[model samples]
Target: MSALDAKKIAEAEALMGQVDSAPDEYAKAGMYFKAATAYRLAKSSDKSKDCFLKAIDCYENNKSWFHAAKSYEQIILLAKENGTLSEVEEYANRACSLYQQHGSPEAAAAALDKAAKMTESKHPELALEFYKRALAVVLIGDATHQASEFASKVSRILVKLKRYEEASKALKKEISLNLQTKSYGQVGRLVVALVLVQLAYGDLADAKKTFKKWGNRCEHQEVSTLQKLLQAFDDGDQELAAKVLASPFIRHMDVEYALLSKNISMPQCIQNGI
Candidate 1:
């Protein structure tokens, strides 16, 4: 009846003609995509899906996630799948979100990672959403230390987003949850984060105190809590430096210290012995 509607029908008919006449699968796929677009414009979701499914089948056979994701979104919208999708994000991210909603976090995280690497800084907000979704799925139904470890990773991304307040809150929540359950490794991680946040805010004394409270509890020597202690010292916090050196966490640093001392002592010993 309307010019726009008629135009769309004409386009759909033309695409259908191509679909019927196309000699090869690729050509048929392209025609189906075009017909699907026209059907979508005409509010014919079922017809759109019919054509889109053909397009998607071809795309999947070709191993093209980009186009497959677009077609899958149409399928998802027509009650074929349950999930959320935002076309404004990257193609892989759309697929990732849908996969996450369908309870496949690992698959979702993988897709999100691919999209994140390709997007660069162009879509930080979308990237943050993917990271949050990954954390949520990883943490779900798990009361163990791994959940807290995942929380730390999520907090790291939040800090990158300059969401410092949220990062602090996340760290505090992780600490409280793990400490209540006696998840010492997680508590250590939280305390270390708290110390870093304090140092970021220029509260050297508090950072030093927090580190002292947590340094030896989780056997944090593997990660070298001394690295952070040295940072405090480098920042001219002499009292913090003294406290850190006296702390048990630094005891493990003896090997590194000895190596340095040996290098210096070796030269002198060699000079004298020679």
Candidate 2:
């Protein structure tokens, strides 16, 4: 280990000694937690986990939630008694959920973030499970901003799951939440995403409708540009298409053009219409 790591281990051992002899339960718990932190810094998570568990025991025995939260957070890191991968995964998830029930939205969000990352690489199903779990806690918790943030994340996970319909629905829900919260920037972003998802599902008519709805709600340059472009495309008017191609609407046409470009063949109707 590096000198810094060795020093942290030494400090943790010292704190553990103090925790062993402290008369006050709160003080003992705090010391144990400190020891765990130091051990964690030293890259000794296995050894550090014991100190955290001890801190949890101490805090719970004293009914000190403030410290209990800190200890539970560390216990989640340890995850299991013997630390099997799946066992630890379940333990962390359950413990984090319990923390959320106790009115800790931030804690729950943090744990869910970790869970999402863990499941993303090795098991997407597991990632989605954690994403849903996090979504449940965020919706129930009092952290509106955090909840909205997690909602955005859940939308991404659903997309990864190839549940395109569900992803579109989730995106729409997030847009509504942002509207209700008066988070104009978030609403703008989600509206764009919603449009893209709709377009992805070949629901051009619905996408057009939603684009119009959002255009009326927003005065953003980007939104205006998108509305014009979508209207132009829907109209199949050469003049409107020419206008869009020459205007800011070009950027807004990217998603549509990207998809359609790949499979584009001149429509017989367009030839007939002209």
Candidate 3:
């Protein structure tokens, strides 16, 4: 180890000794916290994390909710940097719950949001739960932007999971929020997305009704392309559907197109005669 690292390790050892000899829970927690800082400086991340956890336990024993929450936050950051995803989620959830208990709804929501993003790719169901928790907290705090963004994310994940009904509900909330904010352009796009979800769910009649209700609000090019794509699906013309999907205007609806593709048969034109 470098000289500086050695010095820090020595300082950590001194603090650890002090922790063992501390007269009260508060004193012990402080020493452990200081030792954790020294271990971080010594480039011993595992040791630092352990010390931080010890400090958190001591703080909790003393009923210092805020301090315990802060320690959990620190452990979460450390776990994230180490790419220990399970630990990151565990500590983040703990910290968020503690923050909520402390009446810091914004901090609680932010923590859950971070955990949701971190777990979205590998653990989508868990991420969905976290996003829902975050949305609940954000709604209580009047954070429109976070609420809308998180709801959109939840809808996307639900779509991926083929939970179309839940996805539709989430998208409806997002669209309503967009309307409330007078974000007419985004609301138009979201309405188109809602129709796509309905189609994917095999609610063809409802999809048609939604398109008739909101199609004109979207850009003409987008509306025209989506209509042709929908018609190709309805006609069971996979070749035409593929062609429409290949067009740039409709390519951004990749997820919706994928769902549609699964339900349609190959075009007769592309098949050899029996």
**Per-residue alpha-carbon lDDT of candidate 1 for residues 90-149, written as tens digits (9 for 90 to 100):** 445567655655556666555555444433355566666655555565556454455565
| Highest lDDT against the true fold, candidate | 3
Which one wins by lDDT: 2 or 3?
Answer: 3
lDDT of each: 0.58, 0.66, 0.78
Model 1 clash tally, residue pairs: 0
My TM-score estimates for the predictions, one after another, are 0.44, 0.65, 0.79
Model 3 TM-score on a 0 to 1 scale:
0.79
Worst 10-residue lDDT window for candidate 1 reads 258-267
The digit string of per-residue lDDT tens for model 2 on 1-274 reads 8999999999998887776589888889889888888988787878787888788778778866545665665665565333444644664565575565566776766776775675566566777677677777777765566667767777876665556678788877777777777788667656666665665565667877777777566547657666765665565654654554455433444343333323323234533554
Better of 1 and 3 by TM-score: 3
Q: List the residue pairs that clash in candidate 3.
A: none
Q: Let me know the TM-score candidate 1 reaches against the reference structure.
A: 0.44
> Which residues of candidate 2, in runs, are more than 4 Å off?
1-25, 75-95, 114-135, 185-189, 212-215, 218-274
* Candidate 1 residue pairs in clash (backbone atoms < 3 Å): none
